[model samples]
Target: MVKPVIAERGGAAAGDDARNGERAASVRWALAGLSLCVLLPSLGISVANVALPTLADAFGAPFQDVQWIVLSYLLAITSLIVGAGRLGDLAGRRRLLLGGIALFTLASALCGAAPTLWLLVAARAAQGVGAAVMMALAMALVAGTVPASRVGGAMGLLGTMSAVGTALGPSLGGGLIAGFGWRAIFLAGLPLGLLAFALARRHLPADRREDRDGTTGGTADGTARGRAGFDGLGTLLLALTLAAYALAMTMGRGAFGPLTLALLLAAACGAGLFLRVEANAASPLIRPAMLRDPALGRGLAANALVSTVMMATLVVGPFHLSHALGLDTGPAGLALSAGPLAAALAGVPAGRLTDRFGARRMTVAGLAGMAAGTVLLSGLPAALGAALGVAGYLAPLVVVTIGYALFQTANNTAVMTGVRPDQRGLTSGLLNLARNLGLVTGASAMGAVFAAAAGDVATAGAEAVASGTRATFAVAAGLIAAALAVTVAGRRARPGQTADGA
Candidate 1:
């Protein structure tokens, strides 16, 4: 009888081990799906840039008017991301995420079939909404999907996917446009969206049903969280504020006109009002305390500044490559690709390093590297372009992006680690919001700097473009320097707090 019992116990233990292994595998698969979901939106952001010229010719619209195709998408995402996150927190992340994927897929179809440029822009805006939902919830879900010890690695993986998608955009988009036309660019998202949907449906855990009181119960305490009612007022104010700011930055074609000033003022006032409203609200969309947190606040600010510096590469690189180096479009695009490729390659290892070493240390190191690279990029390309040409530019840019990958991974890991479970979605949305805002701002501000430096760029010679590149990157270095100062100040401000200081 004893012998029989021992054998049965061993069999039971083996069965448990097998089930554990299966669970781990399932989690890994789910993470892949989540990474792709992140990738889709990132790809959307870049792929459209390459399509702008093709789109203008196809739609018979001025390039200025066609800018709406990209601007509308960006505006929609920036305006609605926070609300989407809050909605997901209220409804169910898994359910909302699936719906988002479906909506994105549908919007892509609409974009492909739209007969008018305005219609295509509208479809792109709708696609942006879906993207907001996906991006907001994807990061939120990471906490639950992986072991706490591996969160940095997970965050790094998502960053890698995002970088890969952004890098792949121009290359893939150019190919599709060359072979099939502009519509194919949008249509191509269909298969990717479908694959993501299927994987998420199969692997993501279902959200627990809310209690009758409309509160989702937290595991730590039976206390109610994710307030029952939505903060409509807060959401509206934030949307309007972001819209005004985005329009202010993007609409003037690099000119800071009266309209831009008015919009900026409006955004500032709206922001002030938003703060007051959130503070007084029963259930705020974004808790005031969260932003006041030293680590989280500084992290968001750093993300924005770093993103602006990074965008400088994109804004200034093309001009340098084409005009300064006298490269053709194909070569310019290839050279422009070096940054994203470096980012993609560095992302996973950066995350692993963050996990092994620490997010705070990695964050500082990454920023320092970025600051140094931007300083080099300011004059290195122009100084060496006579002989080294593309190498001079790409060398510093690759360094900047690798540092970016590291900073992105470390900063995101640090911020997300300390967030309340219930607020993860909102926090994630804010993180993305900061980054997007930076991108929009950088496009306008950096472009202006370059143009001003190049003076009469329409007829500027190669040397003029090189001068612009130098000046633009000089400004970029300042931005990164500011970002670094913010990070260090935050750390000093909260000496007693952990790296994930929230």
Candidate 2:
């Protein structure tokens, strides 16, 4: 009897261990799927940017019309990200993620097939909506899936994947454009999107919200079970605000007229209305109280600033490389790849560093590096005739990219970790919102500055391009410096804050 009992106990223990191992494997696969989800959209955006001129030529559209391809995507994401995140929180995140992948894949196919510029722009807008949903839920999924101690590392890995996708995008797009056509850029997303969807469906667990009884659903946490009602009014107001703001910014540079002023005023009114609605709503799309948290607020500001600086560089860098240096499309794309490549290589290590040291230190260091690189790049025009001019240009990119990698990983980890489990979705949305807003703002602002300095490139020639590039870099450096100052001040104010809690 005693021997039989012992054998049964041993068998049960072995089975439990096997189950644990299986669970671990599932989580790993789920994370892998999420990484791919993050990567594909990132890759798509960068690749599209490289193919812009080709797109213009193919469609017989002017530069201004072609600009809409990128603008429409940014506008859609800015408008929908927060709402999609809130919906994910109420519904299942996995469900939203899968839906997003399907939409994005379909949109990619549509974009590739579109014959007209307007239709392609519309398809790109659809793709942006899907990208927003996936981006908003990605960090929340990471927080929910990984152990608290490992969240930083996981966030780091996702960051690395994003950087790698971005790094490879230009090169891939250039190659595709050279070999096939501009349409191939959109077609490329199909396979990657489908693969991610399948993996996510197979490996990601069902929604697991904790209640008072430690059960799946209960009233203990103050969250209602089932579908959280959508905030249609809030969504509309926010959309209006973002759309107006983007329109004004993008159009304002070309001509500062009554339309720009009207759009700006509309954006302000929409913002005010959105704030009023959020403050009064029972199930608010964004929690007013959470924004007051020092860690979350400051972290988001830093994120926006960093994004602004990076986007400014990306927008202006290609122009400088091609027009000023006389590099071909492929070589220009390869040159631009340097920054993201450095960022990708540094991303994982930066996350590990964030986990070891606090996020504040890493953020500060990263911003400082960005500031330095921008300042260096600002002087590149004067050195163009020198032997080291190319080196000078490439070196700053490496520095800026490294800084971006460290700052992004640490800052994202800090913000997500600082939030409550239930708030992760909204937090993720806000984080991405800041980033998209920054991208639009940066591009518009830099473009205007470049135009002002360069003044009709057809007449001004290479000198105009060089002058504008310098001015843009100088302005970017200043913005980053301001961000660095804000970060340091916030850190000093909250000496006890850390990013390990989430």
Supply candidate 1's per-residue lDDT for 48: 93
Could you tell me every candidate's TM-score relative to the true structure? 0.93, 0.87
1-502, model 1: which lDDT tens digit per residue? 8999999999999999999999899899899889988999998988998899999999889998898998888888999998988887777788889999999999999999999999999999999999999998898888878887788889899999999999999889989999999999899999999999998999988876541124644422364456366899999999999999999988965897999999999999999999999987867888776777877899999999998888888888877888888889888877888888898889889988988888888898899999888888786745566688788778888889999999998898888877767677788898999999999889888999999999887799988888888899899999988999999887652544464432
TM-score of 1: 0.93
The CA lDDT of each predicted structure is 0.87, 0.82
Q: Which residue ranges in model 2 land beyond 4 Å of their true spot?
A: 1-17, 53-66, 211-228, 322-329, 379-387, 453-470, 492-502
lDDT of 1: 0.87
Best by TM-score: 1
lDDT of 1 at 451: 94
> Candidate 2 overall Cα lDDT vs. reference?
0.82
Residues forming the 10-long window of minimal summed lDDT in candidate 2: 211-220
Which residue pairs of candidate 1 clash? none
